[model samples]
Target: MFKIGYRTVKTAVGAAAALFLAQALDLQFYSSAGILVILCVQNTKRKSLKVSLHRLGACLLSIVFSFVVFETIGYHALAIGLLILLFIPTAVMLRMEEGIVTSSVIVMHIYSLKTVTWPIVWNEVCILIIGIGIALLVNLYMPSVERELKRYQQLVEEYFKLLLHEMAVYLRSRESDWDGKEMIEAHELLHQAKALAFQKLENQFTREDDYYYRYFTMRIRQFEILERVMPLVASLSWTYEQSEMVAKFIESVGAAVRPESTGLISLQYLHELREQFRVMPLPTTREEFETRAMLLQLLSEMEQYLIIKSEFKGKHTYIQSV
Candidate 1:
């Protein structure tokens, strides 16, 4: 069985309503209203508003120009062609090119009526109102996506926890057979969540910054830091004694990562880890030296990771406090 989308159903109902309203009002060339409805319904409310304005402007331009040309040259195919030649350039100049096709319908109505009188103009005006109005009404109530965004937020946090915990496990046991596929999966999830957040931003209709969009963007940045940390983790050998402290800290970071939890405690823990790394005995062998260097780099990257989340949380705190 085939199923129709809600937007499709709304479009059909809106078109029917415009046609019925036009006929009931005894408007001339009533079919134009239905055509206008078909032309005006857009995927987003923002696009619908912009397209409706352009079409309305173009229709008005067409009606006025058709009046001047048909009154002077008489209604004929030649007159319609001449009017279009002039009208296209004018519409382009006015940046109402989107309305060109819809306006042509209005011009044809005038030509068929064979007059440029006020009554004819009024008929086209009514058509524009019914069509654009019904479309605006149809698109007014967008479904809320706050719940979906919350779901995405939780999934992202879960993946962060798992990824960090996996890194901790790897640091502690350098020869784990973990495939690291979760990093790729987490990246894909972030990409999809960001897209959904942007769509939600568009649906908001208000000029306010979206918390979900900002949150997803922060996660994207943190994910980049995590990617950098993985290579450092993979390069080092299993030094259970040396990696013990840092591995525990990484596990703590994974546990602390939450939407409400600021990275303050984790960052403080990171500073202590840095001090501990500094006070350790110097490496005696080349391999030991390289491992120490890799471990230090890992610490730097982890500090940056916690800092990214910390700064994001700080900004939100500042805003809420203000």
Candidate 2:
């Protein structure tokens, strides 16, 4: 249970590599390169690259600031304090706030030397390059999260199937005692699936969109519609012939829930179902009218759900076979 994560291993190896390279090159304060590696490594490629850029920029800025401020005022404790006071605001203004802590280390190294010289400056530059470079190098090999993403996708589909089946059961028999736990479980599963999908999106460098992320987004939208349909189904005390038809349709939709389903066939069937409902005799009793109206609303929500799936599949045709 105390196993190390991939990112943790990356950080450990990167830090050690930075220290080793800096020591081999005889850079001053070689341990600082290890610290830089620790600070730069991140869980995602995009995040790690972004942080490395920010730290690189901030460290360079700190060196320039130190060169100017130390030469002008004198390298004293007060000068170091002044340097940070000026450096922090500049980093924030430039949107490099992530590098503030790492850059501070560079500022101290320059301050400890008590003078600004090209040799000292070159030494700090080497340390910066070695540290950040090693971090970036190690982070280049991000283990594929596709397997985990697929696992979440399977879980979400199963929950959707179960939830739809339960809804159909309730609609068909208004007297059943279903506890409605699947709705909550589906909601939580979609939430986690979306988060994982987004992580997968962030892991890729060139991909602007992820199939799993969009898939989860579409499911979340449909889940919201399902939540609306549930109360309407539960409120029906008297089941009519229309309710039975809708229940069967819901069962079919449940059966269709899978990655390969485009929902186009379901959408066509739903349109036919709507046409059939149009020719049915108008409700006579006040209760019958309300129940029929609610059934109509439920059918409308179901149509929206199918449309969402159809549109999603249309945009990403590759998922049809996946």
Candidate 3:
């Protein structure tokens, strides 16, 4: 089965409309308007506006330069050749280089007519208006992705919970046969969530940043810490009392993981866990000492994890985890 993309469909419709309106108004070189539509349509509304403005500037430059040169030098091969040579640098200087290709069509249209007149210039201006105007209109009707973003947020939290649970299980039972697929899945989910958040951010024309954008960024940073924990868990060879204690703390963190979770409570609980680790009997054997050291490292990683969430929520004044 073949599927057409939404932007593809919009571009097709916009181009067809530009062509139809240009012909209906009896504009000369009406096909150029359609070509402009195809060239100006962009992936995002902001991009479309930018390309349209650049093309408009380039088209105007081409007309002015072509009129002056072709009129004085006579409409001949040399004049057309000379126009190309001079106009390209002029367009680049004006930062309308992206529109150079599209505007060249208008130059050819002027040369083919063998005379630069008011009506000819007006015709090209009309074409530019019709094409760019239609493209802008098409861009105005962006579909909402709020629901999809919410769904992604929910999925990310679910994967995070699963990841914490896996970590807890590994810490509790040193020899468990758990493959680290959940970590990979959580990483993949965060990647997708970040992409979606970026798209959502681009869809809006706002000066202020969206909360979801910040939320996803914080999650992405925490996800890196999560990835680091996996190797540390895999390297452990001994099961100690400290390991289970840390495992229970990780389970508490897993229980509290959510998009709305500030994790401050877990941070406090981590402090308590550290105190418990402190006043307990010291390790006698080298193996026990190594286990305690590993547990301490894991605790540091977990503190970093909670701190990231705290900072994000702190900035926005929103408490997500308790």
Give all TM-scores, in the order shown.
0.85, 0.95, 0.89
- Per-residue C-alpha lDDT of model 3 across residues 1-322, encoded as one tens digit per residue: 9999888888899999999999999998999988888888887777788889999999998999998999899999999899999999988998898899988899999889998899999999999999999988887777777898788888888888888888888877766676777777878877887887777677678725567778888988988998898889778888888888888998888888777688899999999999999999999999889888988998999999999987775324533432
lDDT of 2 by residue, 1-322 (tens): 7899888999999999899989999889999999999999998888999999999999999999999899999989888889988999999999999989988888888888888889998998899899999999999988887898789888888988887888888888886676888788889889998988887888888564478888899999999998998888889888889989989999999999999798989988889998998998889999989988998899889999999998885335754555
Global lDDT of model 2: 0.89
CA deviation > 4 Å runs, candidate 1: 64-97, 111-115, 238-240, 313-322
For candidate 1, the TM-score is 0.85
Clash statistics: count for each candidate: 0, 0, 6
Clashing pairs in 1: none
| Model 2: colliding residue pairs | none
lDDT of 1 by residue, 282-304 (tens): 88888878887787788788888
- Total clashes for model 1: 0
Which has the greatest TM-score? 2
Clashing pairs in 3: 260-320, 260-321, 261-320, 261-321, 262-320, 262-321
Model 2 ranges off by over 4 Å: 314-322
